[model samples]
Target: MAVDLNEFKHPSWITAAGAITGYLLILIVLTVALFIVPWLVFLAL
Candidate 1:
């Protein structure tokens, strides 16, 4: 199957927004997992 990058292009603003949103989501999840899991484990101990 052939994929075309041009066919997938959105408006520059939309593309930028999507990239920023994806990055924020990754950071939020990482922060929660890194801090929250250890705290929960300590509470259980």
Candidate 2:
């Protein structure tokens, strides 16, 4: 089977958007977890 690179092409903006959204999601989750764990530990004491 052969694949065509042209047929699998994505626009630059789409790639950039995907990367930016993924980065933001990871950042938000990390930020939430970072703060929440400390608070939970404090409460458990």
Instruction: Compute the lDDT for candidate 1.
Output: 0.90
TM-score of each model, in listed order: 0.70, 0.60
Worst 10 residues of 1 by lDDT: 4-13
Let me know the TM-score candidate 1 reaches against the reference structure: 0.70
Candidate 2 overall lDDT versus native: 0.87
Estimate, for each residue in 1-45, the C-alpha lDDT of model 1 and write its tens digit: 988788556698679989999999999999889998889999999
Model 2's C-alpha root-mean-square deviation from the true structure amounts to 4.5
Give lDDT tens digits, candidate 2, residues 1-45. Answer: 888777546687678888999999999999879998889989999
Model 1, position 1, has a per-residue lDDT of: 94
lDDT of 2 at 11: 88
RMSD each, Å: 5.2, 4.5
What local distance difference test score does each model get? 0.90, 0.87
